[model samples]
Each structure stands twice: as structure tokens, then as C-alpha cells.
Target chain A: MSEFKQADHKLLVIPGPIEFSDPVLLANATPGTAHTSPAFIPVFGESLKLLRKVLESTEESGSQPILIAGSGTLGWDAVGVNLVQRGDEVVVLNTGYFGDSFAECLEIYGAKVNQVKAEVGDIPSDDAIIKALSSKPKVITITHVDTSTGVLSPAAHIASLVKKHSPDTLIVLDAVCSVASEEIKFDEWGLDVVISATQKGLGVPPGLSVVLASKRAVEVSEKLTPQGYYISWKKWIPIMKNYEAGKPSYFATPPVQLVYALNTSLKSITSKPISERVEAHKAASKYVKDELSAIGLDFVPKNRDIAANGMTAVRFPQGLKAPDVLPKLAERDIVVAAGLHKAIVTEYFRIGHMGVTAVDRQRGDLEKVINGIKEVLGKNKD
Target chain B: MSEFKQADHKLLVIPGPIEFSDPVLLANATPGTAHTSPAFIPVFGESLKLLRKVLESTEESGSQPILIAGSGTLGWDAVGVNLVQRGDEVVVLNTGYFGDSFAECLEIYGAKVNQVKAEVGDIPSDDAIIKALSSKPKVITITHVDTSTGVLSPAAHIASLVKKHSPDTLIVLDAVCSVASEEIKFDEWGLDVVISATQKGLGVPPGLSVVLASKRAVEVSEKLTPQGYYISWKKWIPIMKNYEAGKPSYFATPPVQLVYALNTSLKSITSKPISERVEAHKAASKYVKDELSAIGLDFVPKNRDIAANGMTAVRFPQGLKAPDVLPKLAERDIVVAAGLHKAIVTEYFRIGHMGVTAVDRQRGDLEKVINGIKEVLGKNKD
Candidate 1:
């Protein structure tokens, strides 16, 4: 704890760009290193290898990890451009704001999208998804954990359903908010693609779009005429293969410092069994949810089982609003997110507990959050 | 000098991901800050304002600076998707590798690209450009400095020619290798768009696609249906405007740390007159060219006037190749890039003198590069 010498600032308890470890921050400060230099190549290669371990995917399963310099939204573009051709059928399992946006993105790229949308704070019903799947969509996208609503969809069940019904359909998981905080068995769950970014559970600065593609996904991409220049899988696949083989390659210049920071965070995350990390998040979530429940708060997700472990979306107490609680939290040096999901935009707010805040209990970050909320609510009651 | 406490490593003299200053690297190490946090809003806002100052663009002229989380290649995608609709006629003035690639990118997005080609290490002839413009292309693209061959095209001249030949044609400058290192008066030159990245003349780690678009470009983009999701001007324009107004807004997440580093570098770069920085690059380019010439080496560019001010592409002396010179320089803890142009790949190499290397004389970076080159060439002669 003493080694954490970062300048004093308010705790960033937002869903992403979460608190980073000291080592990760220092790694981000790496001196300028050429993307193709021998020294930087292995850093990139190891990061790729470690990503496989984190997702429980393997080269043996023909899963490839891609790290590009962009936001996670770019991951949606990669899917829309590389996987879906003009007028191809795609089923988007709409959980929250991200689902709507992903569907819109696929539509822009000419995908004929059928979105299965539930009411806000809930996942689409299995019956609706099966109905959408019966159309034999070319791809089905699921948001593992939608940050906007803190709804954790049952990914494995959906993947199993997809395999049983539309066996040839690709299963794409938007794991931007779930990857390091939740249990993701990419190969075991039969996920064809998992799209993510570095800032959330990965505990790095926000710059990289981290993605994994199955062999079938890559093969389908190869058959298509490249629609976008920067997001083309055909160009990036060779570069990823070369870097992972301990050789220097280039499609475009990578963000050198961000990759270094990602490598450092991956090492720390993979140091322990990923299951242990997921369990730690579960513990933190329980702690936070139980405390908030005691304060008479209702959550955005319909039930405990559906809520995300890394983040919580809590509705303001009846008669209280963002102005009343959020400002008080800010005064306490804590920062949480205002609610998204246009259906209930002003009803709730979000707090993120992932990475060091959840896994490193010595930091007592969750306690700070719970106490700050309690104090704010206590004053409101007065 | 005492304030520079970065870890000891080989100097990065490549054209991009060049040596960053201590302040910029340290800023990159900033603790996690949310993209929309009050603390970060000003950093992002100031960076946008500073970018206009660096480019000599003003809000009054309706020029906008866009900073996104991607490489310079993404800038090409933005132009292709935003400005070029299906069957749009565009002219690419091919100087080197980047020109061909930019044309390829534009074509992928449905532009009918007409490329005006020149021989290796030379800009396109005015007559060829005029001929291409006779088609009344929608846009004319120029690589301000093609990193592949170190050829610095006369961007102002081309923009003026485009205006004369086809008044409605947009002028796009790919300044990936020339932004802060060269003179660019966006309004004065009537450039509709200038595409760049942070790693090169900006002296920051690679991750950001920094672009500037004129009012006409924005208005033109708004008229077209967005072709790409992540690079959409319609989506980003509001976000950029909101941030510049010191307000928190989001389209996709910005790279918070990279934006911080970019702000640090931009503040430093704009501290003095931009002309002074350009002249420094000029002085460094002349010094390197003179030293190499004295050592009996020629350059890829046809003459000194047309060569890039930030980097030099020098041909190996008789019987010398990259293998004979680059590895020797690497041994001296100096790193440079091998030649990239396919036509003269084995005959030359590129050395970057930008940012701190070109501007901070106390660092003696250029002297070290020249001395190392002289030693490597002398050993080859012996």
C-alpha cells in the first residue's frame, strides 16, 4: 500500500478507467519504444499469450487475440466490418445501451439486424432469442455485462442454445465490462468472438480494443472483401501471428506505452488463477450489494443473479435524485457514474468495483464506497 | 536535464514513436482518470484548443481538431468514410507508400480513386496533378511527407492547384510524418483536412489519430449517411464540441492517458512559435544531410528542398546495405528504421529528428545519430 504513491485524487469509481495499480501506471510511463523493436515484440507476444489464458481460450482451440489502439466501440466496428456482409442477418441480444448501439453499428455496415430487446434492467427472454435464432442469423451478439444497466446476461446458456439451434451461426460476446471480472470460458462456452477494451476489468488506461476471434470467425472474415481499412482482420491477423511468434511486424503503429501497461496488468491478473479473481469480484459485489440494500436502495438489474459483479447500478431512494446523492459523494472524494440507458436515464447511478479495488482487499476501496454512500443517504434522511 | 529520469534504454530514432520528453512520458503515467471527469475535461479541452494553435487554425474559420483513440491510419478511414460516398471521384497524388495506401483506403470506402504517380523519391508532377483534377474529383489527397521515401510534397502548392482547377474539390493532407515538424497554415493553405498521429512530430507514444477538418468538410460529412460507426464525424462532432466547451460528453470512450500525454506535448510544442519548431527541424535535417553527404552517401529524395524536414532517407554508400549499417548503430544504443519503400528497400534507411531530438539542442540527440552513422560508415569503409 505504501508503494502506491500516485498523486492524491478522488477515487474514480466509474465503470471504466477504474483505479490502476502502481506497476501498471509505471509501465505506462515506459520510454519511447518502437512498435517493431525486438524488445517490444516479446512484450506484445506475451500480452497475446496471457489474454488467451485470461479468457480460458487457447491456441490449441485456434483462438487469436487482437490488440488494437482504439476504444471498445471499435471492437463493434471490427465485427460489423469483418464478419457481417451486406444484408446478412444478425441477431443482437439487447441488454442495455450497448446492445442498441451495437445493433446500430451493424446496421451501418449493412447487416440486417433483428434486435431482441427486453425492458430496461432485464435481459431479453430466452424465448425471444430462440425465435430470433430460428431465422438462422449469420451472427448473434450478446453483451455479457452491459455497463449501462449493470445487467449480466447468462452468456453460457445463450451460447449453448445457439450451438444447439443455429450451429453454424457465429456467437459474438461483447465483454467490455465483464472480461476480467467475470468467468468467461471462451472455448468451453463456444464463443466465436469476445470483444473488450483495456480500461475496465483490465485495469489499464483506455486506448486499446482487445478482442479474440475463433478460427471460424477468422475464416469467414478472410472470405469477405475488406470494407474498412483500419479494422480489417485480414491485415491484423498476420501482424498478430508475427508478433506472437516473437517477430516484429506492422499493420499500423500500435500504442507502445498502452501495450506495455496492458502487459503489466495482464501479468498481475493472470498471476493467480482467473477463477480466484472472479470469486474476489463476487465477494466485493456481495459486500456492496448487501450494504446498499440495507440502506433501502433498489438496483437496476431485476434480480441478484442478473446483476454484474464488477459494477452496481442503484436507483436513487424515492424522492432523491442525482443532484442530491452524486454531489455528496463527490464531496467525499468519490466519483461514480450517472445512469445511462435512455429508458431510465435519471433513475439510477453506477459504481464500479473491479481490478485492484475488488481483488486487492488491502486497499479497502469498497468500504470507502459503502461508507460514502451511507453518509450521503444518512444526511439525506435528515 | 536532471529532471529527465526515465529508464535507460536505446534511443528510438524511428520516424514515429520518436523520443518523448520526460514531461510527456510522465503525463502518460497519470493515474486513472475518467474520460468525462471534471479533472480530465479541461485537459481534453485545452488539448483541442492547443491543436488549433499548433495548426494555425482558428475557431473563427470553422476548423475543428479531432483526437481519437487510434493510429494515423484511422485518420484515413475517417476521411474515406466521412467525405467519400459511393462512386465519389477522388484524386490521390502518389508520392510514396503512404499515398498508395491512402488511395487503397479511399477506394475501399467506395471512392473511384485516380492516382497521379511519380517516380521513387519524387512528388507528382504539376501537369499530372492538373490532369487528374481535370476529372473534377471530389477530393485531392496529398501526403505532406511520405515516411516511406522522405519526400515532402509541396502541400500548399497542391492545395492551391486544386482550388484553381476544381474549386469544389476538397484538399486533404496526410501529415502523419509532417505535422509539428513542418509548416501547415490550415486556413491559409485552404486544406479541408489534415490527418496526423501523436507518435511522430508530436513526440508522444503512438495511440491517437489527431485530425483537423474545415467547416466545409464537416458540412459535407453531415450531408452523407455515416458509413462507419467508430469514425463517424456526425457522432464525434458533438463530442469534440462538448469537450472543447469544458463539458463532459461521450460518443465512445477517449483514451484518457494518451489525451493527457498529448496535452502535455502540445502545451510544450505551442510554448514557442510553431515556426521556430519548424526551423529547428529544418536545421536538424540540413545537418544530417550535410553529414551524410560528406560521408559519401546520397539520399532517397531527388534534392534537399523536397526532402522531409523531420526525417532523412539516406542511400547506403557503395557496397553498403541496412545489414551493414543498422546493426552497427544498434550496437551503439541508437536505433533507426530500415528503408520502407519497396522500390529502394535495400539501398537506404530512415533516421528521425523530430520533437525533443530536433528541438532540444541540449539533448544532443542529432549529434549522437550523426556520430553513430559516421562510425558505422567508417567501419564499413575500413
Candidate 2:
């Protein structure tokens, strides 16, 4: 323990860019290290290996973890340019804002996107997804946890459906909001790809794009001519393989400080059983939703079963919009997010309870958020 | 100032991910801040403004600076997908490896590329570039400093030639290794785009791709239907405009911590006159080259005038290779990079003297590198 303390500030409870651990921040403060330095090769290599553990992927499963220095959106570009050729059909399970954006991205890359849109605050129905698969689309994308509405789709169930109905269809899960907070069994779920980022449940700052591609996804990509350079699998696959083998290789310069932070975070995350971490997030989400419900608040997700473990989206009291609630919470030194879905942007607000706030009970971050919301709502009631 | 110290580690003297100042590293250690937080908005806004100052671009010049979370190579993709349509003719001034890679990226996006080849360790000749311009190519790219060969192309001179011969052609400068270490007058030179990254001369960790595009370039990009979603100016232009006006905006999440580091570094850099910083690099380069020449060492760049000021590529003595020299320097606690250009991979090694190493004499880093190399080679003479 270095006894270094960060300066006190407002608690950040956004859906992503969640609160990070002290050791992770210290790692980010590292002196400059060359991306290909002998000292850094192992750090990069270890991070790749640890990502497999987090996603429940295995070398035996031929799942490769690709780490790139970009935001989570870059992972979408990776999938769009590499896996989807011109005139390929992709089915998007639309849950919220992210699903719509992902569909647009695939369309830009020449995929004829067939979106199975759900009603507001709900997951897409099973029948609609199966019907969309009638055409035997080349790939299907599911937002595992839609940040805009706090809806957690049945990813494993959807993958099972794809396997049963359209055996050749590849499953791509946008796990940006759910990676460490939710349970993701990559091999067991038969998922072809899981796209994520560092800031959400990984408990690091926002900079890296983490994508895991199964053996089948790799094969599909290799058959196509690459359309983009920076996101091409052909350029990055060898680099990732060499790094995970503890060798120095370069396609592009990795973000040294962020990778160090990720290595420190993954070590702490894998120190305990992943199931325990998922249960912790479940407990935190349950506690937050129960407290808000006691205050007569509604949720963006229609039911508890579909609500995400990492965050909660609660509708405001009658006659109150975001302006009436979000700033009041900020004044109490708590930071929550305004709603993102265009349909209900001003009607609800979101509170994140992932990573340290959910897993480490001693932090008391959940209590601070709950109490702050209670006090503010009490005043508004008067 | 706070008394926080990073742990002692080996000095990083690579071309990028160079030695960062303590304050910049401390900034990278920042607690998590929401990308749209009020406190972070100004930091991002100020970073955009300072980037303009560093590049000598002005508000009146209609030049826009875009900061995204990715490596320097991502900047090449941004240029490729945004500006080039099918069968657009492009002339690439091939100085070294990066030029070839940039040409490949453009071709992937459907450009018909014409590369003007240069001799090994030399810049493209003016006569060749003039002949290539006869067809009036849609765009021409110049690599400001090719890190592979340590050859510095005359960027301003190339822009002048392009203006005289092909006035309508867009000029894109790959300044991945040159910005902040060399002088760039964007508006005065009539340049349309300058692509760079944070790690090189900006003295920050490697996570950000900093690109400045002129108003004409933006207009040109708008005329073409976007082929990419993540790299599209349509999605990012509004976001950048809003962030620069101190408002919250989001297309994709910006790398928050790295942006903070960039702001701190740009403040320290522009705190002194930029000309003074350029002169410091020049002085450091002169000293390193003189010392090596006195030891009877040859350089990768054909002469001093065409050599990069931030780094030096020195050919090994007869009968010696990288294994005989690099490890010897490492044993003395000094680190230098091996050659990267394929044509001369084993014949030479590189030493970086930019950012704090060149600007802050108090650190005495340049002296350590010079002395360590001298001692190692002195023993080889035996």
C-alpha cells in the first residue's frame, strides 16, 4: 500500500466511467513506458490473458481477445468493417439508443440492417427475433445491457435461439455496459463476439476497446477483404497473438498508462470469484431499485427481471423533469446521469452502482447515493 | 505543488511514449470524471484551443482540431474514410514506411494511389512530386517526420509546391512524429489537414489521435457520403464544436484522463514561446549528432538538414549488430530503440531526445544517453 490518496471530489455515478480503485489510478500515474519495452510486454500480455478469464473464455475455445486504444464505439467499427461484407444482412435487436446507433453503423458499412425494435422500456420479443432470422441473416447483434434504458436482454437465450434457428448466423454481443457486472459465459453461450470497454465494470478510466472473437468469428473475418485499416483484424490479429505469447509486436502503439491501469484492475477483479462480483452488483442494483420504489418511483425497464445489475433508470415524480432532479442531486455532491434514449430523455434519470461502488461494500457509495436521492426527493415533496 | 512521485523506472527514450513530466503523469492519474461533467468541459475546451496554438492555426483560418481516443495510426484511417471516395486519385510522397502504410490505408478506402518513391534514407524529390501533380491528383500526403528512417520531409516546401502546381488538391501532413517538435504553420502554409498523436512531441501517454482539418477539407468531406460511422466528420463535427464552446456533447466517449494530461502538457508547452521549444530540439539534435560523428558513427538520414530533430538513427560500427549494441546500452540503464525501417533493420539503432528530454536541461537525460552510448562504443573499439 503506497498511502496515496486522491483529492476529494463529487462521487461519479455515471453508467460508464465508473469510480476506479486507488491502485488502478496509481498504475495510470506510471512513468512513461514504451509500448514494446521488455518491461511492458508482460503487462500487455497479462492483460490479454486476464480478459479471457473475465469473459469466461478459454484458449481451448479459440477465443482471441483484441485490445485497441479507442472508445467502445471503435469496437462497433471493428465488427462492421471486418465481418460484414457488402450486401450482408445483419439483424439488430433494438432495445434503446445504443441499438439504433449500432444499426446505423452496420448500415454505413453496407450491411442491410434489419432492426427488431422493442417497445420503449422493453426488450425485443423472442418471436420477433426468430421471425427476423427467417432470412438467415449473416450476423445478429444484441446489446447485452442497453445503457440508455437499463434493459438487460437475455443474451444467452438469444444466442441459443440463433443456434437453433439459423445455425450459421454469428452472434455479436455489445457488452459495453455489462462485462464485469454481469455474468458472461463466452464459450458456454456460444457467442462469436463480445465487445466491451475499460471504463464500465472494469473499474478503469475510459480509453480502451476490449473485444473477444471466437474461432468462428475469426474465420469469417479472414474470408473477407478488409475495408478499413485501423480496425482491420488482419493487422491486429498477429499483434494480439504475439503480445499474449509474451512477445513484443507492433501494429499500432498501445496506450501504455491505460494498459497498466487495466492490468492492475484485472488482477483485483480476478482475485475473487467472478460469480461473487456479479452477485454484488445484483445486490447493489436491487437495493437502489427498492429504495427508489419505496419513494413511489417507476423504472425505465418495465420489470425487475430485465433491469441491469450495473445501473438503474428511474422515472421522475409526476410534474418533475430532469432539470428538477439531476441538478439537485449534483448540489448534494452526487453525480448521476440524465436519460439518453431520445424517447424519454427528460422523463427519467440513471444511477450507476457498478465496480467498486457495488463490489466493495466498505466504500459506502451506494448509501451516499440512496440517502442523497431520498433527501432531495423529500424536499421536493414539501 | 503536491509532493507526489512516480516510482523510479528505466528511462523511456523511444520515438513515442517519450518521457512525460511529473505534472502530466499526475494529470493522467486523475479520478474518474464524467465525459460531460462541468469541470471537465473546460479542460477539453482549453485543450482544443491550445492545440490550435501549438499548430499555429487560428480561428480565422477555419481550422478545427479533433481529439479522439486512439493511436496515431487511427489518424490515417480518419483521413482515408472521410475524404476519399471510390476511385479518387491520390499522390503519396513516399519518404519511408509510414508513407507506404498511409497509401495502403487510402487504397483500402477505394482511392487509386500513386506513390512517388524516394531513395533509401532520403525524402521525395521535388521533380518527382511535380510530375505526379500533372494529373492533378485529388489529394497529396506528406509524412512530416518518418520515424522509421528519422528523415524529416520539408512539409512547408511540399505545400508550397502543391499550391503552385495543384491549387485545388488537398494537402494532408502526417505529423505523427513531428508536431510540437517542429514548426507547422497550418494556415500560412495552406495545408488542409495535419494528423498527429499525443505520445510523440506532445509529452503525454499514447492514447489520443489529434487531427486538425481546415474548413475546405470539412466541406470536401461533406460532399462525399460517409463510408465510416466512427470516423465520420458528420458525427464528430457537432460534438467538437459543442465541446470547444464549453458545452457538453457526446458522439463517442473521449479519453477523459488523457485529455486532462494533454491540457496540462499543452499549457506547459505554450507557456514558453513555441519557437523557443523548437530551438531546444534543434540544439539537442545538433549535440547528439556531433557527439556520434566524433565517434566515427554514420547516420540513417543522408545528411543533417533532412534529419529529424526529435530523434537520431545511427548506423552501427563495422561487424556489429543491434544485439551487440542495444543490450549493452540497457545494461548501463539507458534504453534506445532498434531500427524499424525494413531496408536497414539490423544496421542501426535510434535514440529519442524530444519533449522534456530536449526542453528541460535540468533533467540531464540527453547527457546520460550520450555518455552511456560513448562508454558502450568505447569498449567495442577494443
Candidate 3:
């Protein structure tokens, strides 16, 4: 914690690799330790349990969590390789960039996908989704919070619809941007697979892809011969179980230092009421939207209610763009990402309000971001 | 650099997750940095360039290198998903556990595998490999230092033989344990693929899987409709190319902190003569093997000539086993791995002398390991 929370550099607010707590960063600096050492085994085992709590669940659902050394994209691959097999029909409730990428990944694994695409910053409507489910797809993937447009979809509502209409279909939610900062009830929502990365709301450095799967999902995975080796649930379920049971079994070497950092972040996230964390993110998000809205700015999402709690995507002012604004903010030591929605990439920018930047208000990170944007947008000239 | 070094802890001398350098470890603790920020872009780009040098390659061969946020096992899946499509015939030059594991991974991708297995502590005979190749396998895979047995297969020799017999077959080498410590001339050897991990000879913590591929292999990959998504070369090739040219292109978010650590480690490795580093490993390995043999112990390799330079797998003393000797060594603050071969897991142990532990004789890490083993093996009885 000795001056390592953030180095002598600008703030990172690009939605991922977010501002981390000092304790979490220090944990990343752990010395070289044996992956299977007695000291490390329990730490790993406990971290898996903590992941369940952060996901807002207990082990009673017969669900399991995984920590793999890869980015969030690997989670899409995991869902595709382990579940679809060849010629399986699936439906993608497309929201933004991540949804499109997931469709591409699933197609590579021989899944015949029917995409329900929404306009920018909008989620697929229930009417469209219900119509698509008529095909009796084997899986339905929804991006909980698409980083490309800061579009937060209603995951629980969709899962319930899926359950009522097609109970056999697995629900795969891409929650890369909405794990700790947003609400997720892995069991109560009847979610089957939740795929996320550590760089976002988890408040840890990137390197790990955290995936949670339900009992039925695992049973379905066990029956298929996965088309991938590293992406297979069959190879990893046993290892995840063994580690969670205080023993060491490895299908592949886990990332030791990254896992240490994840353990620290998970402990901090789960020790407090997760609902409080969600409230904090909501407050931070509202602050940014309110301040920007007063400046005559518009958001990518259809309305404030549909915007992601962890981030906001706002259109640039007339006669201004990212090239004109980002550098000015960087001059003030504030960093925000340019819009990533392929169609509107040059039209808007995104500000992330997840992790410590959202919860640890004492740091005034959101205030700095707001102040930086005001100065850059020429709103302070009056 | 500000006192982020290892604390009072035992030395890690396992086959991998070896003792990392202070600079590399400090880099791993880097504070939050945006993955696509100007500050991080060059670091990521330069790391890729340095990786090619470490693998002893030039772009002249139309070869490319990759660094993904995963363990070494992902490399196997990368090759399987990219090169050998389902139903492709491939031959595995089985040396030990790694060979069998690679075979299993390929088969999962629907490859038809013919494994030419070797006896314990040995590699597949050239005659056996030639016989297997006569059927015109699409790929010939070799484990360039099977960690399970410390048997270092002759990669160049095998590649040459494969080319002579099957002119169209691609040559793949798993160099997870041999990358920096062993000599691998990608261009000179006419090899198609060499897969490795960061934790072993690279002196970085475990997380990334580094792979180098030739033009011929890439061409084969370009023609295939890969079976998986995240591991596909088609998705990564352009991103790797863009980053190398100082342009930002996102495929999946890379592991930011791990890539920073790799950049530091790569700079240190590429700034000096790589041959001297290989020589250092050779000397350190000879010292370990000689001392153990003088004490009446044997290695898992058939002889000293075939053993891996980065590590040594030694049979336990006549009157002792891992339970007797490993704990004593641990008490002395030295950590070594027990045997992992399926048939002889209880008969031996492994000591790693790669990277800084092998190169920086000033550190005296190898001396500590030798002294600890001598003290524990009852060598002071006289």
C-alpha cells in the first residue's frame, strides 16, 4: 500500500484496468510463491468462495466459478466451445460491440445464430427476443452491459422470459462491465453462465477471466466433447472443484500473482453489502450524467434508465470530437475512452465509473472526471 | 524499484513459476494504466518485437509472435484450432506428459492423432517418427523439453527429419521449458510453430502464453475456418500487426499488468547476447546434474546429453523419497517440485535453474539449491 495505489500517471477510466485499491495492488506484488504451496492453496480456495458471494450466490445452486488466465473474450470462447457443439441453434440478444463479437465466436464453434439487433445504446426488446425464442434455441446470450455503448440490458427479465418459454435453453450473460458495480443474482435470476473479466468492476488488474456456471450448464457441458482444449469445462470443472476443496489439481497452470490480486479485491468486495456497492455506482453514474446533461450533451443509451451504472457514453458537442477533447482531458491528468460502438466511434466518448472510482468517493475520482470534462467541453467558460 | 522486491520467503525452484527478477516483479505491480493509452501502447508493441528476438526470429521469414493472457496450455489449443482442422492427421513425437497432453488437446479439436511414444526418460526415435510421417500426417508435433521427464527432444533434428519425409507437413514444437535456455532458430530451422510460456526461461511470472509462427503455418491457418474463436489466429494476426506498427487495434483486452512485466523482462533479455544466457543455463544445469550424480542420484532423462538445460529431474536417493527429501529442502527455504510423470511420479524430484537463477551467478541461487540438497541428502554424514 506504500504509494502503489496509482503511480505517477494519469487516472485510468477506460472501463477496464480500472483504478485499484492500494491493498489490491500490493497483493499483486506478492513474491514468487509455489502455485501449489500450502500458503497459496487456501488463498485460492477461499477466493473461489468469495467469487460466489460477489456474484450474489451460495454454493447451494450447485454452481461453480472459474478463474482463468485470459481476457473476457475467452469467456465467449468457453461458452461456444463447451456448449454449442456443431449445428446447435442459438439466439443472441445483441446490444453493442460485445454482442456482435460473441455471435462471431459462437459461429466459429458451428453454432447457427439468429441475432436480434437493437439500435445504438438500446437493448433487444422482449417482443423481439420472445419471437426469436420460437425456434427453440439451445442457448440465448445477452450482454449485460455492453462496453461499446454503455448499454445495460435487463438480464433478470430476459432470463425469466427464457425460463418461461424455453426452460432447456442455457442463459449466457456477458457481464464483463457489470459484476461488482451492478446487481447480479446468479441463483435468483436463474442465470446459467456469467462470463466476466477482472479488469472492470472487480477492481483488480486484468489477466483473469471469471466465469460462473450453473449445475445444469455443467451437466450439459459434461455430455459434449468440447471442440477446444483450454476452453473446455470438462478439463476445468474438476480443477476448480479440487482447488475449492483445499486441494491442488491443475488442468493448466493458474496465474498465481493475478489470483492473489483477485483474492484481495474479492475480499474487499464481498465483506461489505453488495447492494451498497451497487448504490454507490448508481450515485456516481447519476452525478456524471446530470453534470453532462446540463451541458446540453446527449447519451448513447435511449434514456438514463437504460445506461450502464458502471459507465456512460456521451455524444460530443457540435463541432467537437474525441481528438479535440481527449487530449485536453489528458492534460488535466484525466483519462476517458473514445466511443467504441463501430458506427458512432467518432461521434461520442465513454467515461467509466466502476471499481474504486465509484465506491471510494473519498478519492474524488468522479469529481475529477466531471471537472476535467467540464473544462474540456468549454462548459466552464461562462 | 521502490522496495517492491520479494520479502523473506523461500526460493521457488520449480520447473516453472521460477524465481522472477526484481525489475520484472516491480513491473507487474504497475498501477492502473489504460490498455490502449499512449503510455501503454508502445510498451505492448515493443514487447512483441522483443519477443521475436528472444525466439531468435526475423520478420524476413514472414514469421510472427503472439502474447496472450493465458498459460502455456493455451498454445496447444491455438495450434489445434488454427492449423489442424477437424479430421486432420497429425503425429505427436511423445517424450513425456506434455506430449500426451498436446495429443489430447489436438484430438479434442477433432484431429486424428498418432502418438509415437518414447520410453521413460527418453524421446521418440527418429525411425518411429519417420514411420509415422510416411502416412503423410498434416502436422508433426514435438515437445522440446518435456517438463515431466526433463527430456529435451532435438527440435531441429526432428523438424529436419519431418521435412525430409513429409514435405508438406508443418512442424510444431512445444518449447514451454526451453525458450530462453535452449537454442531455437525459427528461421534457420525451418520450423512452423514454437509455443512457450512466460514463467520458465523468460523470468516473468506465469500468465502469458507466447507463440511464434512461420509464414507457411499462417498460410495454412488463413485457409481454415477455425474451430474456436478467442484462440483464432485470424482475429489476432491483424491486432498483433497493428500494435507492432504503433497503431491501436483491439481484439480482446490484453492483460495490462502482465504485459508490462513481460516488457521489462524482454528488454533485459534482448539487450544482451542471448547465446551467453543459453550458456549460463547450460553451466548451471551441468552443476546441478553433476552434484546430484556424484551423490549417487540419477536423472529422468536418459543421460546428461538429453536433459533440459533449464531444469533437472533427478531420481530420489536409494533410501529416500520425495516425502523424506522434499520437506527437508523446504525447511532449508528451497522449493523443488516432485516428479509428475504418470508412471514414476513418486520416484523423483525436479530443480529449476532457468532465467536469473541460472544466469546471475552473483545471486548464488543455484549454490543455495545445491547446498540445501547436499545437507538434506545426508551428504554431510562423513
Interface RMSD of each: 1.8, 1.7, 1.6
Candidate 1 clashing pairs, residues 3+ apart or interchain: none
Query: In order, what fnat does every candidate score?
Result: 0.83, 0.81, 0.83
Clashes of 3: 0
lDDT of 3: 0.89
Model 2 stretches astray by more than 4 angstroms: A1-8, A379-382, B1-8, B379-382
Quality class of the docking in candidate 1, CAPRI style: medium
Q: What is the lDDT of candidate 1?
A: 0.92
Q: Give the runs in model 1 whose Cα sits over 4 Å from its true position.
A: A1-8, A379-382, B1-8, B379-382
The 0-to-1 C-alpha lDDT of every candidate, in the order given, reads: 0.92, 0.91, 0.89
The TM-scores, one per candidate, come to: 0.98, 0.98, 0.98
Worst 10 residues of 2 chain A by lDDT: A1-10
lDDT of 1 by residue, A1-382 (tens): 3233445578889899899998898888888888999889999999999999999998999999999999999999999889989989999999999999999999999999999998888988888988999989999999999999999999999999999989999999999999999999999999999999999999999999999999999999999997799999988999999999998888899998999999999999999999999999999999999989987899999999999999999999888888888988989989999988888888899999999999998988899998899898883353
Model 2 lDDT, residue A303, Cα: 98
Q: How high is the TM-score of chain A in each model? A: 0.98, 0.97, 0.98
lDDT of 3 at B229: 82
Docking quality (DockQ) for each candidate? 0.73, 0.73, 0.73
